[model samples]
Target: MSSHLQAHAAELAHGFSLCELAEGLGHLDMDGADDVLIMGICDDSRHAKPGYAMLCLPRAEGRASEFAESARELGATAIISVGIPVDTQLPSLHLDSMGQAGTLLRRMFKTEQAGAHLYGITGTDGKTSVTWMLREALSRYQQQPVWSTGTLGLMRSSDDIRDIGNTTPSLLTMHAMLAEACREHVHSVVSEISSHGIAQSRIAGLDFRTAIWTSMGHDHLQDHGGYGPYLAIKAGFVCDCGSHGGNVIANADHADIRERAPASSRWYGHGLSRDDVDMGWEQELPGMLRLRSRGEEVVIEDIPLGDFHAENVACVALILMVSQDIGLQELPELLSGITAPPGRMQDVLAGYGQVFIDYAHTPEALERCLRAARKLARNRLIVAFGCGGERDREKRPQMGEIAVEFADAVWITSDNPRGELPAVIASEIEFGMQKPYRAEVHLQLDRDKAIGEAVAALAEGDILVIAGKGHEAYMEVCGRRMPWSDAEAAEKYLRRKNSGTGLVSEGEDICA
Candidate 1:
């Protein structure tokens, strides 16, 4: 086991009694139940072990009571359910609601004393980007280890990440990660709070020192029921931070976010009125960002990306200013070397033309990525993208419309069409294209083939963007996840073309 795991194991060596666990949850009366010893806690029956307390929460698959027997078979000493009485031989604790689960887990794990400044970032887009940017900026500014957890994974640094299966992991897993980070002497933690995580109460008990709202857009509507609920969930995170005496940083460019943001929120954005926001940035030149804050401006040169990223950078700057008391003049050196997280505008090949991979699944994200790609393209800009299965279907045609509007050529391919027909998803996206179809568009269900063809079509000075599934290494089809990557597929085609092994017409000279 790792040192942190060893430390956590040592910490949990003295198990908590049933009475102590109940008391920690503010339940004075344990009724006549025996004071069973609990050494570990888990939500999944598969992870249940001897002396462990299995939390039987309702999952999409089944009810809480259904897993009680399995957990009991795995040697779980007790059962904790949310108002669901389990007919099991093991001792059980019935909670009033699901919200109490996080509290109970945090108490058992002692995560509140994790000794790390916690930062929560929530939004439809740019959450991952801002999380990583803040992680890098803070690490450099503080000269200490700063960790971040998000869609990428549990990252100790940019190059060190351990996949924990979700953007915002389950309450038990989240607390465990935080406790381990504390053991590692990590200075702070930047975490991405997803809408599903919020609705599910995954982050129930942890306290944040600062909460960041990157931007809000139409995403996960099906899960949230509508835009209003989605916006409310994102807004509620920052509002809760403010209520807890934590700092709030929001994007002022978003009107709904601005209106809903807390009164004391430190705002950051682009093109907003000078007096409106606490921090702002503008593209002074190509690959250059000029940040304005507190009547002082600092220009960060060699940005290495598009203008859309300026807002994320500005958000990071504002976070340092608010939380770390870092000065504006220090930002140029602190953040000058910061790079975008993998799969969020990752450049793969740049020889004859350039190929970029991005995780742009939403309409707004797709538009921003395409616009950024368009600016970087000296010649034609081709884009290949698709929507995920069982997600917000409303953005399908919207993304198609955006693709046609910005790209010279569009390839709509499959993106994790889990339990949904890839052809149907592609048709819905195609339905949104302009009537005249100003750009050349094609629907290819095979993602690898689409990427290969798109890469082959790129000429000198041209740019090709492979969107959706940026950093994801697997493609979920039906119920199984198959190993896949857009960056690898693009590079494979690029290598074949460069090595004179790719298919070419008669007498056509290969560019070398």
Candidate 2:
């Protein structure tokens, strides 16, 4: 276990009596189970331990009740079921809905009034970028620890990251992390709130200081059933945060977001003339960005990335300005040292040309990344990416269309074919490519081979983008996660080609 988890476990060592838990959760009638002591709470049976209550909830694949016996054998003291009863001799609490789980867990973990200033960023893309940016800027400005949680995992710093399974962790895990942060004297936390997180009520009962909407796109339709519902879930988060007295920061460039966002939201975007949007930015030179808000303007120099980052930077600036009372003059210095999060346009320098690895799985994100790469490419732009299995299949062809439209070359490869065939996913993506493909496009099922081939083919002044699994260190195949990394594959091929030894040097893992 990591020191972070260890500290969190230790914090819960005092435990809570069954009566206290029931009263905190508003369940006044505990009857005979009032005296049972609960040390921890767990949703997964595999992690259940002595004096812990096992939560048997509904899941996509199966009911958690199927593993109640395992949890019992592992020393679970009680069972908490949501709409489903578990056949166990252990004392249990039955609830009608999952919405109460977060409240109950927060009470169990003693984090109902966590001191950290919680900032939430939600959208299909830019969530990870904005979350990390907030962490960096806030940590620099406050001169204290600032934590963040999202696709990159629960991170206290770049060097301290612990994967809690999903982008938005389970309710039990979320409260536990917050409790840990409080114990560490961390004052701020930025989190990426996914659509699935909102729909599943993972963030329930938590108060956010600010809710940021980055950009809505065509992604996660499979999990939400359709685009409208997916969008509703995103909008619901922003509106809920706003209604609860939290500041709402939205991207004015996205019409859907602009329309659905609360009227009181603070808007930020590029080239917007609306009076409501006080935050806007533009690239004045190759490496300089000028931000304008109200009547003040600040010019940031030596920006290492593309124009797409202008909006992300502007969003970060707006948050600091409104929430932290940070002046515009202070932004240039605080943001000058900020870097993109791992797997977010991370560049690996080669002897010839440039290679970037990004987690651009959505069509909108992929197009933006390719467009940025095009501006830096003097020769040709090549991209290697693949769609994940069992996701929004409609976007596969859309991404294929976008890749060919902006990139001079494309390589379609496997990106975690969990249960579906990689060939089928590639074929679906290829179906959307224009007939008589304008660019040199190849369909390779082997991801490492595809990345190696792309790197080996790079020419001077050329740029290659390896997309889909940015900072991820593992590939999920046949229900097993194997160690893998796109950046590592690209660098290995580049090293071998440059050395002429046909041997690659083992490089240190880059912090994500």
Candidate 3:
């Protein structure tokens, strides 16, 4: 791997002092940074900077501490962040677009055309799965991908998984990643285009040939300000990528994206109806699916569990379909290769029946996931879900309604209640239950307890779905995050129960 790292190293690894870095980007010729004395930058802004010393700190890890440390490590004269107050004077430059730094770094590292190919997948819910799926597919051809999730930060698919900080990575880091890929002569980069990344314009300038929309869901209302704005932010990926753009795989099932696809792009994919598709497909199993189009038949025996993943497979198949250089026929054999994403519809056995852990935090995704799970369930469908703190509140009641509508029992619990009261977020979601629920609904402020209780309550044929915090390894509470894995917790409880310790039931587990 040191060999791979050396092979993919970015020239931008060479750092500069504050003045030199500033001089390198001074007096830009572009829209966002021309003659604009950088005051600082928003994490989301990703406009062009012909010449301007832009401070590039965005991703959660790119906060003050990391930026100062990186800048210092790189021998930068000065670093900037929001933590610097107006009252406290420092050698500072502020810009509206921190993403510009990504562009500038791209240029410095020549990441724009890293010999290593790059690919991106975006949608509200299935970004991670598609990325993983494609990474697994591409690997059969001996290509290792640098992957990232819309929720978690960046990483590569090598044996020594390297964490790249942000989901898409800082421009410098992304450039570095691609540079590394280029050095390795790898074929692709499978990444997710998050709305936050889009809103902030972080991935604005990348050249993507293959783009997939697994499914659409509402989210980031607080960041994008509203539904319309949020949609626009998400549409940026397909809409904005220039001529280097290749085939776009869209979900024919999503109304928001049915006709609203990226402007002037090739289309492919299957759906419930083939009215507007080039490839047709459908769900075959909770984590498996099949797609058939144009003498091509791809059967994914054990794909991944999620209402929208089949559509994601269609999109992925479409990408392979269009990539004449790639073999689309191999999909069937490779279909069964990948496993479940860590938290996205993952199976956990804690108490009675099967426990499903998913990262479905949004109303649309949660409802669909539960409804889908109910179909596979022979007995009770138990849902353990909650919304994140300081996120869009409007979806709460809607999520509540979906929970009540699908699951036989509902347990409303905390999910990343970052700085917000768990009760407050829970109450909003509870209000959305349209009718009185026939199933049981419990409220346990502690997430682990909720999982334990839900697990305990599951019968032989029962299914428990823990939504929100998908693929996330930790749980956030009161501004602090401790180690927490929904799958692990459920599995622990189930193992204990299976080991003759006990059966999980409502209020039975002391943890619950």
In candidate 2, stretches whose alpha carbon ends up further than 4 angstroms from where it belongs are: 1-13, 24-31, 60-75, 86-90, 272-274, 350-353, 500-512
Instruction: State the local distance difference test value for candidate 2.
Output: 0.82
For every model shown, what is its TM-score relative to the native structure? 0.92, 0.91, 0.80
- Candidate 3: tens digits of C-alpha lDDT, residues 264-372: 5445554535645667777756666777665566677766666566666666666665653556577777556465456767666422337778878888788777877
Q: Which parts of model 1 have CA positions greater than 4 angstroms off? A: 1-13, 24-34, 58-62, 350-353, 504-512
Candidate 1's displacement at residue 403, Å, is 0.9
User: Which one wins on TM-score?
Assistant: 1
Which stretches of candidate 3 lie above 4 Å from their native place? 1-103, 142-152, 242-245, 266-275, 284-288, 295-298, 324-328, 349-353, 503-512
Per residue, candidate 1 scores C-alpha lDDT tens digits across 468-507 of 9998999999999999999999889888877878743221
RMSD of each: 4.1, 4.8, 6.8
* Model 2: how far residue 85 lies from native, Å: 3.3
Candidate 2 lDDT by residue in tens digits, 1-512: 22333221223647877766666453333356877788877777778889888777656125555677788899987777766656767777766667677677667667778888999999999999989888999999999889998887788877777776788877667777778788898999999999888898778777888999999999989888899999999999999999989999999889999889999899898863446586888886656778888877888776557676767888899999988999989999988757788798888763343999989999999999998888889999999999999889999999999988898888888998999999899889988897778788876678888887787777888899999999889999889999998888888888887776553222221111
Superposition error at 239 for model 1 (Å): 0.7
- Residue 235 miss distance in model 1 (angstroms): 1.1
